[model samples]
Target: MSNDTFTSWENLVKKQLKTDDINAVLRKENLEGIDVKPFYTDVQQPLVNLPKIEESTHLVAKYHESLEEDVFAFLLNENVENLEQKTIFVNNVDLAGHISPKEEVQYFSLIDVFDEKNATVNDQLVKELLAKQFKRNICIDIALHQNSGASISQQLGIALAKAKELTEIYGTEILEKLIFKLAVGGNYFFEMAKIRAFKILFNQLSKEFNLNLTPYIFAETSLRNKSVSDSENNLIRSTLELAAAMIGGADAVYSNNYQIGNSTDNSEEISFKQQIVLAYESIINVFEDASNGSYYVEDITKQIAEKSWTYFVETEENGGYLELLKQGNIQKDIFDHAIEEQKWVEEGKIKLIGVNLYPKLEVKKSVEELYNNTEIKPVRWAEMFE
Candidate 1:
């Protein structure tokens, strides 16, 4: 529609709502403070011309030593082809004894040295590891950011800052095999735009260093919105989250178990099957850029990128990510947001089904303890309500 036609429609909306400001009646604010209008004609500003992303996402499953063969057997039984192409995220680095010689699966190690969930960074350990020129993927796991209640822009900015700090400490060689593990939340469109926006911001950061780097983003479902009592609803939540990750153009996707804390026996298989159904049956992986021409998503992506870039710049000026973490700035911001969101849930402002609204009579409270004395901690929002 033309700008003139848009103005006419705005006038009609204003009259219907009986308000002078059309935005006041129709616009909504997202968690990142971005304005979500009811409709869009065209993008006001195009930030970055996004390149064509891959049509298919690589499936990533957690590796267990005992159930290694069983996992493969299950996949094969389900007609999952190309076993070699699948990625395995394992906590153990010593895969020599575990994996079969015939299998050619890729492994993403979760070494504590690089994991943000480890809380404190052992500088000497990191230097020692980097000196050996770690060949495996050096994960910058900002997935904890979302699980800790960080906003979308916060995640992007923090990821960029973390990458910058690592490059400065360990040199640019680390960027070659760096993997960004992000947590995909339940907000369908916003979560999709978050991944797209991060790519733009990361590219901009790379340009500042005179290097062209394509990020390998591994998207997983967030634990923040998951509830122990209402575990059944978690399945539906994770499916949408996985869909968001694939549509957002993640290099890899891992759907976490819907059952909270090993409550169900086949939770791992259930999670893996979620990916299988989305990839094969639903055929969501067919599109190169599913949300490419979407005006709403495009606008949200640009806004996130711009805001995140500004946050990154400010962060760099203030001694980067680690320095801020040591000063408790990063942790404080995330903790404050976490508390605020929990309060919203408590007051019934945020309707997390089966938590604040329509809760079960015999719901069990989460054993996941809250940490008040940590740097940047992981938290679940439903913990408060339960």
Candidate 2:
């Protein structure tokens, strides 16, 4: 192990370690087709083509009716540079009232904020919404489809369709107004790669459209991982997810109550406070582009981007976004991915802390009580075990 004996890590391995020892370890591959090695000794140069994720990450808080004043206080006290607000409205009236000519909120749903069936904007309100320069341009919430059922790659492909269409119709100007909100799950590396993959794919599509625009992005904790039984554990999930959002280079990340159908002030407050801790107390923000040079992460980002591009092209070839959805191609793929994830939970391969791995010895709520009380969607992952 002399310093002079080390030329490369591989050379050191060969000289100091026996072949039998190295050969004994097994490699695992993820759904992204990335092979996980026990140890990575052969490091590659940073991927020059990829982008570095710097944290201009804003801390986002959910606007709650029960804690409206408190939530507002959180926002008013929060540094403008580090905070943004997400107004979760059940109807258009709410959205219309909440929207203003000027506000510091980073993102919210205007497309379908009123109702699920009629997601389009009305004629009269268009004038008001268009009157002001929003914090960003059109909002494409990939998290909505993701929380509904889309897989990592599916989320990317779905988002690409929206980006391509918007950039084509609106041109590069839309880029300045573009904002993508993604749902980050618990798979640390995969989630980080997910954001990177979408950025790369969108960047390429922008080039094809002859437009130069960098995506403004952020993520919310995945509803898929939230458990009603173990409410405290959901805080842990939020913490990890927020970390993933930071590592993935989100411009800002927000937290929401994971009590699922039941939005308690307790859960909401705990989740909201986690953001304050992450940005103010934790040094995770100190390293921007931390995963930029990793062999596995860079490789996975490229792979996910490639696969996502294939889906995007195929969807366009078949006739574009809405057409694919009409043909059930979009729904079918998302459903299939959701089923696969559900299978993992059912089989105990994916563990939900209070639901599966550990025995609660009793039910937290009746089966019906657990179903969504809020219009915000609940995921199939936590429900599978129940």
TM-score of each: 0.82, 0.77
Badly placed stretches (over 4 Å) of model 1 are 3-22, 45-55, 63-86, 93-105, 115-136, 360-374
- For residues 117-160, write the lDDT of model 1, one tens digit per residue: 44356576455444432234567788888898888888899999
* CA-lDDT, candidates in order: 0.71, 0.63
How far in Å is the alpha carbon of 57 misplaced in model 1? 0.3
Kindly list the per-residue Cα lDDT of model 2 for residues 1-386, writing each as its tens digit: 34454446555575566554543444553445555665654456555544433335666665445555444322222113323344232124344444452365533333421122233324344334444455543566778777865668778887888666655554656565656778898888889888877777777877876776667676778887887677778888889898887777776677767676688777677788787788678756455565787777887787788888888888888877666655556666765566666656666677777877786323333333433322224464676555
lDDT of 1 at 327: 76
lDDT, model 1, position 283: 83
| Candidate 2, poorest ten consecutive residues by summed lDDT | 112-121
Candidate 2 lDDT? 0.63
What C-alpha lDDT, on a 0 to 100 scale, does residue 352 get in candidate 1? 76
